[model samples]
Target: MMKTPRSFDHIDTWVFDLDNTLYPHHVNLWQQVDARIGAFVSNWLKVSPADARKIQKDYYLRYGTTMRGMMTEHGVRADDYLAYVHEIDHSPLEPNPAMGAAITGLRGRKLILTNGSTDHAGKVLERLGLTSHFEAVFDIIAAELEPKPAPQTYQKFLKRHDVDPASAAMFEDLARNLVVPHQIGMTTVLVVPDGSQEVVREDWELEGRDASHVDCVTDDLTGFLQGLGAKS
Candidate 1:
């Protein structure tokens, strides 16, 4: 477990990553998206499902996102790709009362930072009954198609929201993506997925010394905030 930084008192705005961070990964929303991508790849490339999966993984690894790879290599349009991938029904997502309460508990302007389109983010928020918790949803479209891990994207987001980096917190499921915000002095929290046995890797630690900015790492959102003395 990592220790919480004493400088965390400066964090005031809380930016959350939608999708897997808002809900547990076990809900299988990404599994549905993965299947859709595989099918699209199989049909478009005329390959077997297994072969298509391998190709998709190859693209995802080569480009930060498979859509980026497709656009670069095959000239796939970004809008169409994002629409197809996010078309999965989100009715299966049940709201976590605990998460709802936790979001309400965190004192600050709450915003959603996502690579997904705003429409997709709205659907997910509605599904999780968390639409009211966020002051606004910042999507890939709003960021001019730049995604997370891109320093410019983070800069644009903070500027648009008038968020002070020294007074903000970003909670995300992806450890690598958290690096940019952590570097900019935002309190970073890594939400470990349930049932995952792998130890949480510290991006800053992996780079060298402990990240002077990262604040906490935990699987339980509510418990973590409660420990932080956040009040509803």
Candidate 2:
């Protein structure tokens, strides 16, 4: 049932981004963390909530991640920031055995490359019942705080896994993050938010669906993977 054997025949590594990429955006789990992020910035800078949001977005745009921006420009402690932002309730997430089955079908070494901490990745994967699907996790801490879209971060990940770019695929929710991977010869897939997403997203984040670097785009990751030889 493979949709296109030639497209994935050489792949031996499957890299996934945690958070919005692995799960549907409608889960609302990340909205809680996002709100916490704004609050943390407001408290840290003694700025109004509105101003804090601006600062947060600005940093995210400029540095690929708000945490990296905070560290580079404001000397924020990584551990404290990560812990504070991720303290919200985990009740929003629900396990998806179907998705796990699809992931289980991929014929390669699976991995998670995330800008967030590994602890957060563990919690999300556990909730999704996908903890065993991935073999290794390359988190922000492993990147030395450099976020993705940074060529060097991707380089380190590729080197660590001994991944041949031509034989690997990376799935990410953020379109911009795939730029470097595309340039380096990896097949890049963009996981878009489904229609069920009631959560608001920035206009800029939604603007890159037509970007040349993205090899595939899909709102239903399960179907996409299934088409690529996953089980129903």
Candidate 3:
């Protein structure tokens, strides 16, 4: 419940991370991607599921993303990895009219900034019934496969999109990912898991609870947006 940035009124471009940031973490849609990554690693390395799981997480820690580590260490193709990992049933996600209306009511441009591929972002937005709200999606592939928390990728995204960081507000589920954005002067909001749901995941997923560079922490995105007051 830390005070959100008072400069929120200055935001002209809203940047949001896809995945758990957009959807309720309780839905566990990421479980499918996590499992697929483990399976891909297991099959590619000819290792047991337990060993593959370890390697997958190890890479995720070492590199910003498992795919990045795999590419650097194992010469894995980016296309292959992204395609393989994103193959999941997105049906678990339910559309939120409240969220859609809230986002629609917000002033200025809305963009999706995600480590996931454009296709994955599109599908998630579609499932959430928010496809039309976003002006553009800056995906991992668009960032030259470099993931968030990487300064270069953020720089590139800003330059490519003509976004002024100071006038932007970013929403992300991962706290670490918000560090660079905050450092670069964007208002950072951390989307926490719903208190009512059970969450089982990695250590990094839980790391941002400390709220280092986080300006705001909210489990209710729709309500948060609704409470932001009417657009100017």
Candidate 4:
């Protein structure tokens, strides 16, 4: 059954998650990063590929992100880890003029709240041809290395951006990341893959599909934004 889409007429701030939210997950952009992470774990811990895979997934489950788990357990350097993991080809993402146009037509400020570094976000936005659409990019470094699904990080992002949660709408690929946003009075939109099964990288990612916290669910971000702009 199609749930009635929540109204976002009061929304003045548009927040988005970078990686899969900005670009489609089907592009397999995260696959490169995932492989790099596994390699990092294998080399750093001097473990077998199979063992590293276990640790990688375990960390993702225990902590919001593998990086956070590594930092807490192994005292890993964030800068080095982020640099290595994000060192991948951005050529897979073609310039999305429709997405860019849709975003540009939205009212008020548009911002990116990503667990990735500023450098990584810049590379993606450049490839997507959306470099000029966003007003700011709040990366992990700005959040003191804390990732999404953390209330503290969301608080910091809201404070730093001076965003009123009541008048804001956040678009994200992960359903868990929308929880805090929804709890804090922001309209939450979950951007799931179109006509595909949910890609479960972690346990938390698989939860929240019932749309209890989500105000809206959309497979087509560009189309959603276009409709939103037209209504506005």
Q: What's the TM-score of every candidate structure?
A: 0.85, 0.94, 0.96, 0.94
Q: Write the per-residue lDDT of candidate 4 for residues 1-232, one digit (tens) a residue.
A: 7655557898899999998888887777988999999999999999999999999989987688899999999999999999999999999999999999999889999999999999999999999999999999999999999988889999999999899999999999889889899889899999877756444355566457677788888889999999999988
- What overall lDDT goes with each candidate model? 0.77, 0.87, 0.89, 0.89
Candidate number with the higher lDDT (2 or 3): 3
Which of 1 and 4 is the better model by TM-score? 4
For model 4, what is the alpha-carbon lDDT of residue 3?
Answer: 59
Residue-wise C-alpha lDDT for candidate 2, range 86-112, written one tens digit per residue: 998877778988888888788888999
- Runs with alpha carbons beyond 4 Å of true place in candidate 3: 1-6
Candidate 1 lowest-lDDT run of ten: 200-209
Candidate 2, residue 187: Cα displacement in angstroms equals 0.6
TM-score of 4: 0.94
Off by over 4 Å in 1: 1-7, 196-214, 229-232
**Candidate 3 lDDT over residue span 47-94, tens digit each:** 999999999999998788999999998999999999999999999998
Q: Candidate 3 at residue 69, lDDT? A: 90
Candidate 1, residues 22-97, lDDT tens digits: the string is: 8776676877877888888787789999998888888766565677677788888888889888889897798777
As a whole number from 0 to 100, the lDDT of residue 51 in candidate 2 is 97
